[model samples]
Target chain A: MTEKSAQRRPGGRTARNRENVLRATAEVLLHEGYEHLTVARVAAAAQVAETTVYRRWPSKAHLAADALSELARTDNPIPDTGTLEGDLRALLGQILALIERPEVRRVILTVVSLATDDDEVVAAKVAFWESRFVGAAAIVIRAVERGELAPESDPYELIEDLVAPTYFRLLVTGRPLDDRLVDRSVELALSRQGICAAPVPGRPASPSADD
Target chain B: MTEKSAQRRPGGRTARNRENVLRATAEVLLHEGYEHLTVARVAAAAQVAETTVYRRWPSKAHLAADALSELARTDNPIPDTGTLEGDLRALLGQILALIERPEVRRVILTVVSLATDDDEVVAAKVAFWESRFVGAAAIVIRAVERGELAPESDPYELIEDLVAPTYFRLLVTGRPLDDRLVDRSVELALSRQGICAAPVPGRPASPSADD
Candidate 1:
């Protein structure tokens, strides 16, 4: 590729080429995972040079970050259901769907790993969450303002409680983010019935110290 | 430098030496962080051989993991005040204290990152949480038995809500784990007063959509 090609698209062809490169990167990441992600493979799959790929992104982490950012751009917004539970269910359901997607899940893990060590990547991840998480926060905030949530509640903390476990499951257990799990989580978070009450007979039971 | 020497401590050397090794490793981590952690440097600082370190831990991460595991074990257990809120407050307070340690926070983030991609490392992480979260869950179970909690609650979910967000803040936002945050979280997870109720004035407005 030419020097100019590295910075700006020669034409619409360049834009299309960048998209193809990103698409192929996501595909490889989904199929082979971050461990196998390589600039050479992306270039080959996108029919571009290794240099071309590197020119656009400094590292595989950077590439994956870009792809996730692109994915979030069109992410479905949580519906404006008037009830907190309904809205939470919808929102959690949507997040669950995204978490369940094979490639998307891999990308998410990859991005989180990148966020852990790299300041630049962390900045990017924070920016993405600032937009996306903030958007989610707005929905909850609206619910709180409308007397649907407790008066003393903080929406940020509420979001942390509601959504953090799902991400924790993703990172720690690799648990299936199915509809059932999402439903239960949403129910527990929004109702206070699940978290506040005592033990259920048939549930997993309290984790013992022996755990 | 012999294999036997590497595997065993030299006859009755200062116990202070071992402490120095751990302290030096922590200092290096605070200065350079986990990504730059090296067995060679740690060994040099401790006045131990590379072979000695190798015999003890196969990798830098393993060394760090052991250090962290030991740190967590040394921390005080969650206090029992016969109230769910008090117990959680005590547990979360200990956790926050761990994160506030000079280099401990970075070590945890490093572990969480490794856990994302490495299942063995995650298993170690799981073992770590089992000590904290699972142990806390036991308190809730006992509370249920004592009729302190509502009869119908799920202990696992309750524990999940209580502890999950603290881990989330550490891993996600890199936020300092503070008592105020823990207090609010415990209050929300334990009580129905603020979280699930319809929003009232000065609070976020109520969710309009009823299920």
Candidate 2:
């Protein structure tokens, strides 16, 4: 049976070909924003037929999204440091490093802005986040269980507060994201009892006590 | 000469004309996103000649920034309710109202995104913030005086934390900038210090200590 048709192919040639195409797509995204990214260019760079490229991904935007999604997943490793502040520092630090790569930040900003107007791009972004959110949430939930965060707080918003400032300044204000800022953000959020410090609802202890 | 030449002739008419043009520009911005805005459109809406608009503001981006600067100046009111919590509530509440106005929010995002590429736009944004930051700082300083915040803390970053999340979510996530979210933001910031009743640094007292 052809590798492409097989439901469970023991992959060698087909999978390597796919990886090469994705790597080429990522290179294009790094060099050009989403608008200029072309499937033909990717096909040429990947040494594959345009038909083969089209058979796997119908659009350049989808190809670019997939490439970036793959990069984001692998490059930024989420650390489970057993504390909310430590975890945020680790995760946001990775994000900062990712942004530090020139043109990557611009590409991500362009992708996000385009996503605002395109449903397919938005779905791609959501899918990317969906792949990571569960892992990120595990870190937060562990922090809560360990009394590093206030038990009553919503982990999502708490994470948002810690990292959103950096993203806002980086993407909107054209500012560089840095580690000092990340540490400050973690301190600021954790000090508020909203991360791992919020007391569990209906299980509040003495005023100075933890849940 | 005419009023135009009179303003150009080093007199008060320049300020009045600028104000009138700025007001008209703000009206347009409040109605349309920055992408859809134009200098000619602003001039028509302001009842000013196209040359007159060009004579002062060089481009649509400049006109939009100037309009926002004027708006920021006019609404520089942050209520001093003698508590950090109340102060933040009022301060954030004002921002919430502004973001809820779709036209203003759209213009803000457009201009902010443009700032990434345009030096002139970035300068205009910086200048606008220079004026507004003073007002925002005044509120934070007052909170320090009233024993509502950490006396030695950096007011700028604190304000950044308080405001960045909502703007981030609004512009990036396209979420509804609702009051509940605003309230939670204020609460999170305040819970860190005695925005409600923490005494000054040298003095010792936690008003909520009884709880």
Candidate 3:
């Protein structure tokens, strides 16, 4: 087997090294800011050889991008709960929890700050958002199949409507987040599909259970 | 008369000095960023004495706060179009125009970045948003008076819904802003008030005109 394939084997030294390096990268980016982040610093913090980090991730931009993407992936997993409301609540719950962390808030604000001037960061930011939208698309697709959403509904717009208020409150307005915001967001998004949260007369109490 | 009263006179030298210093403070914050902004640098840029700037705004944070607040006030004026839809469209249009400027975007991102670490900046941000909400409260109050909305509708929530998506797209999703998004935002917020943009059959087409 090739050396690269061998290194990439599950639970191998390379896997451990990657996790350490990404964790160090995030720590440095969060505490020290982006300008202070370097491959050498990350490698030293991770207790790995500098050459190893360079060989695996050629640039600081790539390192930062991967670190953020990893954080997003691990912190938020797509929920497959039966009802769209349940799925939305679950997904938003994960997002709210993730962003509430001091480190996560710093990372998000820092990336957005850098993205204003750095092309690499801009690309990374766009890719990060695209991955999130793609992952959440399944929730929309499932709702459409279940007749909770119209077949012609755009998943991206629906998701945007659902999460924009939360992010806006957090990042722009600096307002507090509470259960009311979460419930209001879900209600607004579902309302767009003409799917009321309250049960109507003569309708199945739980549509997913009947299906 | 008190010495402070003399400085407060309209079109006086003190007024010109205040204008110059504020403009210079914004220039430094926008171009050099928050970390680089100082009373000395602003005084130099404004062609005023350092003591003059220090006397009025004692701290960099105070200067930064005033500069941002000044930017927000001059760039956007609350619209009084005599209709909720017209007012929302006008207000959002101004916001879109302002944020699309590179300098304005930098100022906004910079303040948010600094607010995370600085107590004064946090207070400043809160005050900035409060002023904006208070300014726009007139729109909602007028709409209610015209029977266009429920009397109990929360004005803050209505304004939040109207502007959150735009800020979210700009700062979080990094998406392009267009007329469609603006229209959709206005529609969604108005829909919450049960106000339809399209006229129904056998109704006064222009409700504002009828009033």
Best by lDDT: 3
Q: Give chain B TM-scores in order.
A: 0.60, 0.73, 0.82
- Selected candidate, larger TM-score, 1 vs 2: 2
Q: Candidate 3 at A186: error in angstroms?
A: 2.4
Per-residue accuracy of model 2 over B38-98 as CA lDDT, tens digit each: 8887778777788988887777767777788778666647567776667777788887887
Arrange candidates, best TM-score first: 3, 2, 1
Q: Write the per-residue lDDT of candidate 3 for residues A62-137, one digit (tens) a residue.
A: 7888787787788798899999999999999899998888877877787766655666667767777888889899
Highest DockQ against the true fold, candidate: 3
Instruction: Please write out the lDDT profile of model 1 over residues B104-210, one tens digit for every residue.
Output: 66665555556455655655565555655565667777776665664445555566666667777666655546767787668756653234433322322432233
DockQ class, candidate 2: acceptable
Instruction: For candidate 1, give the lDDT of residue A59.
Output: 73
User: Between prediction 2 and prediction 3, which has the larger lDDT?
Assistant: 3
Q: Residue B23 of candidate 2: its Cα lDDT? A: 83
Write down the TM-score of model 2's second chain.
Answer: 0.73
Query: At residue B76, what lDDT does model 2 achieve?
Result: 41
TM-score (chain A) of candidate 3?
Answer: 0.76
lDDT of 3: 0.78
Per-residue error at A75 for model 3, in Å? Answer: 2.2
Q: Which prediction has more favorable DockQ, 1 or 3?
A: 3
A1-211 per-residue lDDT for model 2 (tens digits): 6754673343687777788899998887788766777888888888999998888776766687678777877898778876777788888888888888878877866765663556766666665556566567777778867866544455567666777788767755544466678877787666655332433334334334533
Residues B1-211, candidate 3, lDDT per residue (tens digit)?
Answer: 3547766664567788889999998888787778788788889889989998888775787788788778878889899998999998899999999988887888778776665666766676777788888888899899889988888888788888788889888887778898767766776666655565553234322211222
Fnat of candidates, each listed:
0.27, 0.26, 0.40
